[model samples]
Target: MKIVLIITDYGSFNNFLSDLAIRLKEDGHEVSVITSETRVINIQDKFDYLAAGIKFFYVDFPRGFNPFAHYRSSKKIQKILDSIVPNIVHIHFTTGIFTTLFAGRVKYRTLGTFHGLGFPVLSGLKKQVFGAVEKFCFGRLDKIYVLNEVDYKAVKALGYKNVEKYETLGLGCDLSVFNPDNFSETWKASLREELDIGVNDFVFAYTGRFVNFKGYDKVIRSFLKLYSKNSKVKLLLIGGNDPIHPTGLTENETILMNNCEGIIHIGFTKDVASYLSITDVFVFPSVKEGMPVCVIEALAMGVPVITADSRGCNEIVQNDYNGYVVDVTDDNWSGVYEKMEQLIINKDYINQFKSNIQQDRNDYDRNRYVICEKSRYEQYSSIEK
Candidate 1:
């Protein structure tokens, strides 16, 4: 079967769906990826996809709200669809869904995977508008896959009956890459020395775009408070700033991230698992997520987490078990600070979380995700026949 997967940008494709595309191609299906030409596509990313026998098609789907741009993107998608005439069309993210909606109706088996709904973070007019658009687009799809209970409930609330939750929890992590056993103590110590981190330092790490809704600012604030009290604490920030995003970090936050002494901002690197290996605690205070892959990766690395009580996060983190899930609201991050302090004071708790994580880590292996996705595609193909 010829299948086409649509997403927002090349970066997202590289991060989330590249492995799936490769696996599908290995399964003897012709798979192609369609994404907006927004970010600069890495040459190696293209080479990897081409080598995997997957095709690439680019369109301009603006990340932010712009009706004219979306219309143009939809027309471009329509042209591509006419050319490819795929047996299956699978959309991902809000941008992909909205652009496909503008392309009008098609005869292909349509499916969508909502990473997270935009309306949950919006309010007033924006919330109402996005919510209505989501319902309309959702109803048009033949099948829908959601990452978290919040999204599943939201789709069901809209009376959409074909929705199913991703059973592997989020998109699943590459266990082979993120496994703690892969990194030896010698290698970890050498990397720590290179980064000027003391062997005994309590490292708190976060890996994701430094955007507002991600709550990096909240993480920073809490870390700062902890650092003031305990000088042995260090914050490791992976990933870079997104000035184009609607919720990009403020000038003050960016400046602080750069100037802070205890916080090490290592822009963006593909080797997130390496950094996670040396981390004692992974802090993610994002206000919203569709089942954060980073959290799963951390768990796979045997690192405990301190995250917010949001939809996807709440499901992964059992309070006082693998990690602590704080109830974060607006500017109130006292709970985050308190949790950090608890981990600092009670060192035994960290070991306990790591022990619990070892037993539960296999549940997030990426192979499971690949198998589940392949089965779904085969089911659709059989139906088409």
Candidate 2:
């Protein structure tokens, strides 16, 4: 079977779907990827895919809203689809799925994996607009795979006739890479020393694009407040700003992230596990997500997470068990601070969460996710379109 995987950026492919692509190829399927070029695209990921005998096709799939850009992207996708004539078109990310669906008629079976629904987190007019767009696009897909219960429920509620199946199979983490046992105490201490992180410091890490919706500003503000009260806490930001997305951080927030003491902004690095190894607690306050691989990775590394009570996050975090799930609705982040303070002051509380994570970490392993995805592809490919 010849399969074409479509996504918004090469970075997303590298971080999330690269393993699945390689697995599909290893399963004897001819696989190809279509993505937009961005600074986040790791050249190593590109070469790795090429070496694995997978093909690459670049498209201009912008993240922001622009009808003209979407139209142009749809045309480019249509051309690619015509050229490839793939058996299955598995599109990821909302932007990529929308653009490819907007391409009008195509012969291949379309499968989309909604990372998360933006409309659920959005308000009034924007929510209505996105909901309508989602309904239209979803109605055209042959199959759908949602990463979380929230997304699955949202699409199921739409009751699209064209959608043959939609399941909540989360985007899994590479447990072998993120496992805490992989890193020794010596390595952790050495890395901490290099980063100027004190051995006794309670590290709070957030790894994602520094964007408005991600709520990095809220994380920074809360960290600042905590830093003032307790100087032993440090915040490690592991991602860079998203230039293509309209939700990039504000100037003041950017400045704070870069200039704030006790806050280390490491920009972007593929070595997230190394940072996670030294982390005491992982903090993600994003307003929305599909099933965040970062949160799963943190859990896989036996690091407890403090995240928002949003769709994807609330589902992953069992409140007070794995980590605290703060209610950040209507810009209420007091709970975020309170939870951070609780974890900081109480070592026992942190240890308890780590204990729970150790028992349940296997639930987020990448091998299971890959096998499930491969089975789906094989099943779909064997069916006559």
Candidate 3:
């Protein structure tokens, strides 16, 4: 079977598509990708975009629409789809391009994978309000995929049937790069030395983009409360800043970054797993999420986790079993601070988070779950085969 993935964000380094492409090809299916270019988007630009034997088609999807922009951009995407003639179309986060919707015009099967935007109100409502338009856009999809249970229900509530909700491949972490054995204890200790952090200092880590909804500001406030007492806790914020546009950083984010207390902005580092290995605890306080790959990486590395109470997160940590999940809100931060304090004060708890991660590591491989994606795409695209 041939598989083509559609994504609104694509550059040299993004792994979401690259990872999936490798999985599909290793399983013997031919794969291709249609990506929306991000000139200023560096999140996934460092890695080889064409690593796997997959062809990539570029289209400038009107990420945000203007009448003229949409007209030209959408046409460019449509032309490429016409040429590729994919047997199966897989759409990821349909923010910029409308090509998948247009592809629905063909007899081929198409599927949409919901990575989810973290808003309590189910922010997907914006595109879906236009039922006829969405129906036409979706174009006889064989299946629509959701990573978390909330994502599944959100799409279903939109009256979208023929949906498949897959369990996460706890393998969200790149085990190849993130393997616990890859870095020895001495290497991790070197990281502490390089950062000028004392070996005994309680180092806490918060990774992922520093956007408001991601809950970094809340984490800083909680840290202030912790620091007021002069606790030894220190933090490392990975991806704490994005280029202030060729234009400028948004005032809200800029203010938050400038004022973040006791936080070390590492800028962007390719050596995530190494830093993650040396960290004492992994903290996640996102207001919304769809199975954060960051937390999964932390778990696979055997670090204890603290995440905001959200459905996608619930699916990962069973609250007090694998980790702690408090209702994600600004007011409940004190309780979150308390939980981290317990782990900080107790060495045994940190040992537990590490000792048991290997037990659950095999459960989240993208191959097992992602295969269902190809299977569904195949079943729907063909008739009486």
Candidate 4:
């Protein structure tokens, strides 16, 4: 079966997109990806290399809610759909309402996987356009893949009956990159040395845009709380440091670092899986998510995750079994992810952390999710007798 993956969430050799393409190929399905732009400067080389083996289409993303932009984007996608007519059109992220261009072009199935809470810049009137498009696009679909329980409940409440979350069907990671078998003693030694991390010191990592809604502040605050009591924990912040957010790292991160000890700040880089490989615990205290790629990546890497008690993150983790989840939004929000981020680091934490996932890990495999999605496409693409 041929599948078209629409990505409006991210750009530039992204793990989510690449993993989907490669895994779908492995599962015997033709895969293609369409996106707005890479958005980041100087990453074109990496993107070009990635596009070599994958089918890619790029459209200029209309900045404002211009009617002309919608006309252009829709026409571009319509042309592509008319030419290819994929069995299933899977939307990974919708950039603005303009994404409705090809949402329902296929006569078969249109599966929209809500990737995250709306982009931070979207609010009030800007959101109206998105709602109009989403309602129309979703109405035309055979299925909607909600990544978390909250999104599932929200969609159902919004009057959608045919939606099935399949948060498990959301993008997973390459477990091999994270597999301990692939690690070389030399590489492991150098990585530890370069990060100034000791063999024994517990490494706590939180990966995501340093934005307010991501709950990075909670990681800082919680880490501070933990540092005050015990100085053994080490903190690592991974993501682009954007200052515009109410909780962006520019202002708060400085305060967070100054007030907290045993912290390391590593800005944007493509070696996220490498970082995940060494990390003992992964912390994400997001207030909202469609379904987080970062959290799923960590889980696939076999690192236990501590995320917000919100919808998307909760679906990936089991409380006190795989990891911990307590919504810190109520109060003491600062020390949230950090507070629990340390739990996985502490070798002594014992029963609180499930060191070995074993058979439990199969449920979150990327290959399995892709297969399920492709199966849906095949069944829908076939003529109903």
Candidate 5:
């Protein structure tokens, strides 16, 4: 079977979907990718895909909705669809989701996975407008996969009965790469030294794109409050800022990140495992998410997480068990700070949570989830045929 996976950016394709593509290929299927130049600052060279023996195509789709951009992208998608005539079409990210919806008369078996609620962070009129758009788009897809039950219930409640299908997919992590046993005391010490981190200093790490919806400001403010009181705490920020992207950090956020003390701002890199190895706690306050891979990766590394109590995040952070999920009210930063302070002051509690996470690591293994995805694709292909 030939499968075409569509997404908004090459980075997501590279970071999240590449492994699945490889797995599909090994299962005797031809796997290709279609991506838009949307919400991504760093686009990988064609040689990168060529080296991996996967065919790649790009559609000039903008970050957000524009009538002209959508029309242009639909034409491009039609051209690709005509050429590939894939057995299955899997779409990811928001732009790709909307593009597929508006694409005229899709003949292939189409599947979409919601990374988070379509209009989760939006409010009032904006939410209503985008929510209607998403409902219309979702109705067109043959199947939809959501990361957690929260998303499943929300999507199901959208009232698309007898047409659209929904499934709650448990996302996974690469245990081989993210396992707790991957690091040693010597290696941890070396990495800490390389990053100018003290041996006894407690490190709180955040890895993801620096977007406003990611609540970077909230985390920064909380970290600042914690840092002012305790000199032993440090912040390790991973991921880069894409200025072209609508949700990318604002000018003020960039300035704050630069001026912050005891905050190690390391730009995005593929070497997340190395950073995770040296980190003590994982902190992610993303406003919206669809089963974040970073959170799963952190759990696999036996690191307890402090995250926002929103869909996707709440599913992973089993409050006071593996991690703490704070409510994102008006005073979101204070809520986060309290959780961070509690963990920082209580080493025994943190260690216990780490142990609990280690025991449950097998549940988030990448191989298992890939098998589930592969099976779903096979079923869809059979039905389509």
Candidate 6:
């Protein structure tokens, strides 16, 4: 079977598609990825795709939800569909949702995986209006897969009968590469020394784009409060300050970055696992997410996580177990601050969280869950194309 995946950006395709392509190929299926040539992509990302035996196709999908321009992008997708004539079409993210809606019905078996719920970004009236559009899109797909439970409930609320949930492999980390066992305690100690971190210092790491909705500003405020109280705590930021992300950082983020001390910003790099190994605690205060891979990777590394109380985050972060899940809202940054402070003062709690994480690392392994995605594809392959 030939399966085609449609996604919004090259970065996501680079992060996720390799393992997926390998999984499909192992099943004797042909896999190809279709994405927009919008974001800046690395030349090595292309080689990664080539190495996985996956063919990559690029198209220009208009940024954001524009009904007018989407029509033309849909026509382009239709042309690609005509040429490839895939047995299964897997659409990802919002842009892919729009492309599927605009392209209309097709002969192939179509599946959609919702990565995030964008309704919260809209106003009351606009949200209700878009809700109808969302329903239309959900209704059209032959099968639906959602990452987080909130989206699962939202789709169920739409009363759709053909919805099944499947969590994609941690989009960024392959467990074979990210496993904590690969790095020794001495290696982590050496890395800390290399980064100028003292043995007593508490390293809090955040790995994602510098987007406003990710709530980096909130983390900054809390980190400042903690820093004032104790100088041993260090914050490491791993992603780029990309201004083009829909929820890109605001002026407040710039002010925070400029004013804050003991905060190390290491732009973006492919070596997130190495950083995760050295990090003592992973802090992610994203306001909206659909199963962030960064948090999962942190847990797999046996580093305790402190995340925002959002839909997808609930699945990975077990409060007082592996990490703490503080309430996520506009006025709850202080609540986030309080939680971080509690972790800093209590070494016993951090040790407890680490112990709990060690026992359950295998549960969140990337290799284990990619099988779920492959099985779904095989189920779709059984149906006549």
Q: Which is the leading candidate under TM-score?
A: 1
Which run of 10 residues does model 5 get worst, by summed lDDT? Answer: 160-169
Native-referenced Cα lDDT, model 5: 0.77
lDDT of 5 by residue, 1-385 (tens): 9999998777777777777888787777888888854535343441355666788888866666687788788788878887999999988865677876675657888888777765655789988887887776687778767677766666767665533323322557778888657788898899899888998999999888766567666777778788889988889988876575443435785576678768998777767888888888899877778788888888888889998888778877899999898877545478888988988888898889988987888887878777877888888888843
Candidates ranked by lDDT, best first?
A: 1, 2, 5, 6, 4, 3
Candidate 4 per-residue lDDT over residues 163-255, each given as its tens digit? 787736466655655465567778877897898888777788888777777887677767776767767678887776544455544566567
Between candidates 2 and 5, the lDDT winner:
2
Q: Which ten residues in a row have the lowest lDDT in candidate 6?
A: 39-48
Among all candidates shown, the one with the greatest lDDT:
1
lDDT of 3 by residue, 1-385 (tens): 7777778757421655566677678788877777766633345344454665678777766544455675665566657766777677677763532444543244455566656533323447654443333444444556666678876776677676876676554226566676778888798788888887777778788887766566666666666666667546678877644343121235664565457555566755557777788777888877566677778877777777888887677778766666777775645567578877788778786677666666887665545555665566657667531
Q: lDDT for model 6, on a 0 to 1 scale? A: 0.77
- Candidate 2: what lDDT? 0.81
Q: 145-256, model 1: which lDDT tens digit per residue? A: 8888888887788777999998988888888889888889999999999888997898999888776677777788888778878888899988766776543446776676
In order, candidate lDDTs are 0.83, 0.81, 0.65, 0.66, 0.77, 0.77
Evaluated against the true structure, the overall lDDT of model 4 is 0.66
lDDT of model 4 at position 123 = 64
After superposition, candidate 6 runs with Cα above 4 Å error: 39-47, 120-123, 167-173, 245-253
The collision pairs in model 1 are none
Q: Count the backbone clashes (under 3 Å) in each candidate.
A: 0, 1, 8, 6, 1, 0
Better of 1 and 5 by TM-score: 1
The 10-residue segment with the lowest total lDDT in model 4: 40-49
When sorted by TM-score, best at the front, the candidate numbers are 1, 2, 5, 6, 3, 4
Q: What CA RMSD would candidate 5 show? A: 2.7
Once superposed on the true structure, which residue ranges of model 4 sit more than 4 Å away at CA?
9-13, 23-30, 39-53, 62-67, 96-98, 102-109, 116-133, 167-169, 184-187, 224-231, 242-246, 249-261, 334-338, 341-346, 350-352
Q: Which pairs of residues clash in candidate 4, taking residues 3 or more apart in a chain or in different chains?
A: 218-334, 219-338, 221-334, 221-335, 222-334, 222-335
| Candidate 5: regions farther than 4 A off | 37-48, 119-122, 162-170, 244-256
- Measured by TM-score, how close is model 3 to the native structure? 0.83
